[model samples]
Target: MLNCLIIDDEPLALQLLEDFVSKTPYLRLAGKFEEPLQALQVLKEQPIDLLFLDIRMPDISGIDFYRSLPYKPEVIFTTAYSEFAINGFELKAMDYLLKPISYEKFLTACNRVNDFLAARQLKEKKEKDYFFINVSHKMHKIFFDDILYLEGYKDYTKVHLSGSPNPLLILHNLKYFEDLLEDKEFIRIHRSYIVSLRKLNTISRKAVSIGNLQLPVSDNYRDGFFALIGEHAK
Candidate 1:
């Protein structure tokens, strides 16, 4: 299911979108907010897949709001003006709907969003299954399931395998590995550490244990780390 949120200052517009979203079987309405800042807070607290955003609002422009987000969801701009259409497309929005949006148009936009997500999921599945990295002038195929954890320092990241005593050091930052292994069962608990969720033996608020290694969970990534592990536990 696509978890969606609506952010429009107009009360009537919000109600209309809410009604339309409720009728759609695949789109689940996670929230509706008149204030963009409040919506941003809710976004941090929950997982949102799609956004129905208004272009012009009292607090901030929808374009700016979307740009400010660290992790952007698929967006469908809803505005009374047509001038913002070009800007919306530049942001790679799923669709742009004029005010007084019809159920037909809304449904069409929803279908596009569904198609985009499906394609992305299929691509991520292939990436997560296996990947190759250049180490010691050799390209090594590393399966996601065989990885235990990774440690990063400077521009080099060491990939630790399940049973290997020596790790493969690749000239890549932690952020590179984080994005590469995002869809796999791996969680970055600290700036220097990304551990395989499948290999985790125990977890606490401040730390996680993988085999005999106990890694610290930094304050910056603690909430997201815990959330990911909690989902894995289920």
Candidate 2:
């Protein structure tokens, strides 16, 4: 199912979107927020595929709020104003829906999202050979062979590379990165850590060494983590 979040200040608008979301079989309403900040927090905490965003909002405008996000999801702009049409497309919104959205218009927007998602998935399948990292606010492509280890902080994750002095600090949830890196080369030894087997130096019952750094293997993932990394301690 395609998970989605609706962000609009108007209670009525949120209700309408919620109703529309429920009527669609392929879409699942992950959450709805009258406050954009709350919606942002939910997006950060969960995996959301689509965002129904209103253009105008208090404190921070929707355009600015959307730009501030490190990751971009398929967006459909919902607003009463038509002035933001050009700006919305500049930000690459999937489609724009005028207020009092009709079921037909909503279906059109959903079709655009599905088409865009399909293209993205096809691209990922073709490039399944490499991973991408965020550095200086840009997605810097990195091959799977270059990673050394991963460390999780409160709101960001650090990716240590082969020859780079500083690891890339990506604005992401550990679990999100964990899901993105579930291939054979990467293994999560702890809730807060993932390591590249290509860079594995050593392993113990409690800790796994990658390069000069030693990360603890937590009890929760120790078994599956070791199995992937070739430590079958029966």
Candidate 3:
């Protein structure tokens, strides 16, 4: 089942989307929020597969809010204005749904999401130590052992390698890489970093060292990271 969230300022719109999610067998409603910021923690802590985002809002536009997210999910933009469709598609949104959405349109979007996720899960389940990343519009194979660390810069991540002098930059968030590398030989040491377990040269209470490079371990991820490395931070 695809877990979903709805963010709309209008009570009626929220209720409408909530009803649609409830009626769909494959879609589960994770939460609904009037303020986009209210859902930030939920987004971090829970697994959300899809989001129904309202385009216009008081403080933050839906487009901006989606861009700001560290963890991005498949999104369907719902708006009263047709002009916002291009912006939504530019951000790689699954669908652009106009306001006053009928059940038919909603179901169509849900069907597309289901199909896309089906393919993605299949791709992920493949047994391999290396995964392919899109680089310059082409799929580039990256092996887990070659990775030294990962650096995050907003929506972009830098894949540092053992032999390569320069890191490979990809259009993916740190959180995305964290999830992608889950159950693998990787541990997130900071909001902006993830390091290979086999590549870590040294570990301290507030930082880790790899290949002569030092990466700070933030307070948030300190304990979990230490435990993973089998160290007791003082």
Candidate 4:
């Protein structure tokens, strides 16, 4: 089970998050904090897997509090302001939740955590890895390393495997794979595509090649993708 914490000055927000956490079977509420300093103390004392943090607390802002930590848990930033969306992501938050957060949206955040945990387990399993993904008629076993890339289409995803003649189409999206693979070993070079890092052979200004397939990099993602490759370059 994942240990979760809710840090919000508002009593109602904390209660709602606590209730949501309680209903989720995989999560255990470690503590709730009205102050960011108190939450930091809790982190120093024990392990926490996830944090639901409100951005505008009195003592220290949530973003500042999050940055102050020596080690950080996966955070879902909860706030009324949409202005903080980009900044929250820059902090590497799991998700940015707009408050008066709906139960459905909160559940979606929990699902993201679940997918993140599952992918970490699969990576740890390594040689023993096998992922069962539901397709049209039945579930299919997919080996982790054999996947070349995944492309998200409207209400569906097309899985491009290493040597497959055709893409295996499934009802999923880029978001599903993003949460499922967080080791930074897979990258979203395009809004719709997540490519396996191990599969990349050469990268140029416009395209990245995996084997003989040259995939175009979207303009918006180009700089970040280039920086990632440069940072990890041999």
Clashing pairs in 4: none
Among these predictions, the greatest lDDT belongs to: 1
Tell me the spans in candidate 3 whose CA falls farther than 4 Å from its real position.
Answer: 127-234
Compared with the true structure, model 3 gives a TM-score of 0.55
Q: Model 2, which residues run further than 4 Å from truth? A: 129-234
Tens digit of per-residue lDDT, candidate 4, span 32-77: 9998888777898989899999998888899999998999999999
Q: Clashes in model 3: which pairs?
A: none
What's the lDDT of the predicted structure labeled candidate 4? 0.87
> Model 1, residue 180: displacement in angstroms?
20
The superposed Cα distance between candidate 3 and the true structure at residue 214, in angstroms, equals 54
Q: Ten residues in a row with the worst lDDT in model 2? A: 225-234
Instruction: List per-prediction Cα lDDT, in the order shown.
Output: 0.92, 0.85, 0.92, 0.87
Cα lDDT tens digits, model 3, 199-231, are 888878988899778999999998888777764
lDDT of 4 at 149: 88
Better of 2 and 4 by lDDT: 4
Off by over 4 Å in 4: 127-234
The regions of model 1 sitting more than 4 angstroms off are: 130-234
Error of 1 at 68 (Å): 1.0
